[model samples]
Target: MPSKLTTVLAVGGVAVITSNPGSGMHALVQEHQMGILIEAENQQALNDGIAAAMSQDTTQFSQNARRYAEQHLSLEGVMRGYEQLLLTC
Candidate 1:
C-alpha cells in the first residue's frame, strides 16, 4: 500500500501525487477519484495539478477517501482480516 497516499485519504485530505511508473498512484487516484496525479518531475504538471485541486469542488473526493479508509484501512477491517487468516490457519 502507498502509505502517504493512505494517510492523506484516511484523513479525508486530497493528495497531489506524482505519476511514477509502477507506483500505482495513478490507479488509486483514478479508481477512487480521490486526488490529482501529475507527471513525475514535471514542474508544469505539478503546478497544474495544484491549481486543479484548489479550483475543484472536493466534496466527492473527500467522501470517497473517507469511505475507502473506513472500508479498507480501519482497525476493524484489519482485525477481520487477521481473524480470517487465523481461522484458515
Candidate 2:
C-alpha cells in the first residue's frame, strides 16, 4: 500500500515538508525536487524547512511531485508493476 504522503502526492498538487531520518523518503523527495526535507527530530531544521517551503514558489515542486506520483504511484502504474512481477514469477 502507498503511504499517506504518497497518496497525497498522487492526488494533489502541493509541496511536502517532512523530516528525514535515513528513510528513503528523503531520497524520493530530493530526486523529484518535490518539497523540503529536514533532519529528523531537529526543531530548528524543521522550522527552517517549513519556512523555506513557504517562502519559495512551490509550483515546480508540486509539478514534480505529481509527475513522480503519476509515473510510480498511480493505480495503473502499480498494476503494471504487479503484472511484470507476476510475469517474472
Candidate 3:
C-alpha cells in the first residue's frame, strides 16, 4: 500500500482500494487488515467499484484496523521483517 492508504488504515479508516486488473490491489488486500478491494479494467468498472466500496460495511473492521496496521503493516514492522530476513543468512 501507498503512504496515503497506509495512513488511512493506521487511523482506523476503511479504504476503498482500487486498481487495474493485474496492476494492483491484491497484495494490499491479502496483507492489509482493513479495506475493500476494487479490481477494475475500465472507467465504468472503476466507478462502480468505488461506489460499492463506499456503500459497504466499515463498522465491521474499523476498530481493529489501526492496531492491526501498527502491529503488522507499519514502518517499524517492515524494519523488523527486514532484520529478520537478514538474520537467516
Candidate 4:
C-alpha cells in the first residue's frame, strides 16, 4: 500500500495525482490547475496515469464543467444584486 492525497480544483474541475513533485504533476497543475492526488501506488504508476490523461482528449470534461459553471455560477449572475456596492465611492 502507498500513501496518497487528493486535491480538488475549484475552477478547473480536473483531478491529477503524483507520487512525487515531478513533471507528471507539474504539467497538469501548470496547464489546467488540476487538483493533485498524491503518493499513489508508486512513482511509475502515478506518472503513467497522469501521462495517459495528458494523451487523451479532455474536451468533453472541460465543456461540461464550463457549461455548469456558466449557468449556475456566472460572475455577472452572482453579482447581479450588488450593483450599489460598485457605485459606492
Candidate 5:
C-alpha cells in the first residue's frame, strides 16, 4: 500500500499519483484509482496504462468532456471556460 500521506490529485478524472515506474496501470485498475500515475518506466507502459484506464470507464473519462465542451468543443465561452479551469488548477 502507498503511504497514508500520499496525495492523489484528480486532474480531469486522471489520478495523478507518485509511485514507482510501471506501477500506474495496476494502481489505476487494481486500486480503482484512475488518471495518470506519476512515474512510468517507459512510454509503452504509460500508453498501455492509459488505454487500460480509458477502457475501464469511458464515462468517467468523459467527466472532462463537459469541461472541454465548455472550453474548446464550441466557440462561445471557450476561452472564458478555459481560463476559469486554468485558474482553478
Candidate 6:
C-alpha cells in the first residue's frame, strides 16, 4: 500500500527516464495510465519530455492520478488484482 507521503508528495503524476525501456514497472506504469516515459539515452528528448511533463501539472492530471491510484494502485486495488490473478491460477 502507498503511504500518505507517496500520495501527498506526488503532484506531478509519474515518469521515468531509463535505459531499460519495457520492463515490468514501465509496463505497469503505462498500464495504470500514470505518466509519461522518457528514454535515458537521449538528453534532448529527455529534457523535452521532462518539460512537457512539468507543464502538465494541472488539476486534471491530479484527478486522473488519484483515480488511477484508487482503481489500480491502492490497497483495495492491489488486493483486487491479486485476487483476480489467484482465481485465474
All-Cα superposition RMSD per candidate: 2.3, 2.3, 2.9, 11.1, 11.3, 4.2
Candidate 6 lDDT by residue in tens digits, 25-75: 556545555556566578887888778767766455455567776776678
lDDT of each: 0.84, 0.75, 0.70, 0.50, 0.48, 0.61
Worst 10 residues of 6 by lDDT: 1-10
Ranking of predictions according to TM-score: 1, 2, 3, 6, 4, 5
Model 5, position 53: C-alpha lDDT score: 65
Total backbone collisions, model 2: 0
lDDT for 79 (candidate 2): 91
lDDT of 2 by residue, 1-89 (tens): 23777866876556545657567777777877876777877888878877887788878878887888888788898899999999999
Return the TM-score for each candidate structure: 0.78, 0.78, 0.64, 0.34, 0.31, 0.55
Candidate 3 lDDT over residue span 21-75, tens digit each: 4654666454544666666556676787678667876675565568777876888
Task: List, residue by residue over 1-89, the lDDT tens digit for candidate 5.
Answer: 34221222222444433456456444443344334454545666667666766667655543543343344435576667788899998
For TM-score, candidate 1 versus 4, the one ahead is 1
Where does candidate 2 stray beyond 4 Å?
none
Among all windows of 10 consecutive residues in model 3, the one with the lowest summed lDDT is 24-33
Residue 37 shift from truth in candidate 3, angstroms: 1.8
Q: List the residue pairs that clash in candidate 6.
A: none
For candidate 5, give the lDDT.
0.48
Best by lDDT: 1
Q: Which stretches of candidate 3 lie over 4 Å from their true place?
A: 30-33, 61-64
On a 0 to 100 scale, what is the lDDT of residue 40 in model 4? 52
Q: What lDDT score is found at residue 43 in candidate 5?
A: 68
Per-residue lDDT of 37 in model 1:
77
Candidate 3 lDDT at 86 equals 100
Q: Write candidate 4's Cα lDDT for 1-89 as tens digits.
A: 11122212325344554535565655544444334445655876778667856887765555544553454346774575366567784
Candidate 4 deviant stretches above 4 angstroms = 1-49, 76-89
TM-score of 1: 0.78
